[model samples]
Target: MAFHLRPATDQDLPFARALTYEAMSGYYLQYGLMWSNDGFDVAWAGRENWLICNDNAVLGFISLSRDSRALYIRELHMLEACRGLGAGSWVLEQMALKAQALGVLRLTVFKNNPARRLYLRSGMRIVGEEHCFWRMERVCQSS
Candidate 1:
């Protein structure tokens, strides 16, 4: 199924937080870190968020922030049942398009997150490493 993205609203917080926790809680536990939704509201209010939807079904959400040099993907989470169906790739394509004029698109993913493979397939390369995550970037091709 094809998906569409719409600007997120206040009502999406609970859904977005739940989806994020579902996708990352395991990584947090594996890395000996605690998962908390503590500053989600404050951060959410400061970034641009979009809900990934297929008609009336909400499949996931993507959060982003940008600087003159790059568009950073702060978060991208899809429902477990909704993965492996091209949504993540589709989102990446959309983000890349959004970043075309920005020069680059970047994100950080847990070192062992399976999504890293998807990022790699989508043309993102690891440029740096943190204690537990890989910082990746895809340089956009200007048309």
Candidate 2:
């Protein structure tokens, strides 16, 4: 089945946060960083978030923030069953299309996170690093 995206609602925040913790806690642990939910509500309320779905089921969610220079991919978390199914790559492509005017699509991934492979495969290159994260970006061809 093909996955689709829908705008995230307040009801989706719990699922998003749970999936984020499930997907990211290991990385945080490995990097010796704490996983904090302190401001997730405030941050989610302020960003553009979407739920990735297939049929009637949500597979994951993505969060985005934009500025003059680029569209930032704040979060992309999928259920374990959805991983390796091309959903991440598809989301990156969609984000790239949305970012054409800005000319850049950027995200940060944990230094040793396996999802780095997905970003690389989707045309994102590591341009720099900050602490335990790798800053990656894909330059979009503006129309």
Candidate 3:
């Protein structure tokens, strides 16, 4: 199913936090990710969060930060029902277009993220490592 993105505002911050906790509680504990309010600080969400929605309702949120150099996807989470439905691939395609528009050759994904496979399938190849994350890049050809 095709998905849509809506820029999240400060008023949506609390919803973002709640959704993050709901979607990631298991993975967070499994991966020993710091479960703290610090990560969801208001300032951070205001800047990075964007809601992923469809005809039914809001599904999840993605945190993206971009600059002239590269587009950084801080996080991408979806509701349980959205899993295995090709929604993530649709979003990745959109990100690739954004990268191409900006003329950047660098994009990265966390090595441990389950979505790494999706990234690899979408044309981004693992290029390097930094800490626990793997940097990736794919030439963004016009679609």
Candidate 4:
């Protein structure tokens, strides 16, 4: 399904947060990774959150921010049923386009998360690692 990005509103925060937990909680547990299972950071979902939506509803959310030298992707997640449907790839592609010419695009993926492969396939390279996460970056050529 084709999806578009829009700034997430306050009303959408709960749905986005729940979807993120549903999509990721198990993976984190399975990997024995420490996570915020205790609660969520609603404040962090403010302006930077972007909803991946189609006609019916939101499929997921992604968060981004930037400095003069780099665009940072905080999270990119999809609902369980939405996986393998190419929506994540599409989101990342759009993110790359959004970040291009801004400077390097950077993100961290759980070392065990399959999305690292999607990042790699999108031309992002693993640049470093910390704990159980891998720092990846894609350098967009300046025009």
Candidate 1, residue 47: how far the Cα is off, in Å: 0.7
Model 3, span 90-135: residue lDDT tens: 7777778877766544555556777788888988888889766688
lDDT of each: 0.93, 0.91, 0.73, 0.80
How high is the lDDT of residue 1 in model 1?
Answer: 82
List model 2 lDDT by residue over 95-141, tens digit each: 99999999999999998898999899899999999999999999997
What is candidate 2's CA lDDT for residue 126? 99
Model 1 TM-score is: 0.96
Model 4 C-alpha lDDT per residue in residues 6-118, reported as the tens digit of each score: 88877876786777677678878877855573345644543388888776677788878788988888878887777787888888778778787786889988888888888
Report clash pairs, candidate 2: none
Per residue, candidate 1 scores C-alpha lDDT tens digits across 105-133 of 99999999999999999999999999999
Error (Å) of candidate 3 at residue 39 is: 3.0
Q: Of 1 and 2, which scores higher on lDDT? A: 1
TM-score of every model? Answer: 0.96, 0.95, 0.77, 0.85
lDDT of 3 at 83: 79
Which candidate order results from sorting by TM-score in descending order?
Answer: 1, 2, 4, 3
Query: Which candidate has the top score in TM-score?
Result: 1
Q: Model 3 compared with the native: what TM-score?
A: 0.77
Pairs that clash in candidate 4? none
Relative to the unseen true structure, what is the C-alpha lDDT of residue 34 in candidate 2, on a scale of 0 to 100? 81
- Weakest ten-residue segment in model 1 by summed lDDT: 34-43
Off by over 4 Å in 3: 22-33, 42-46, 105-110, 141-143
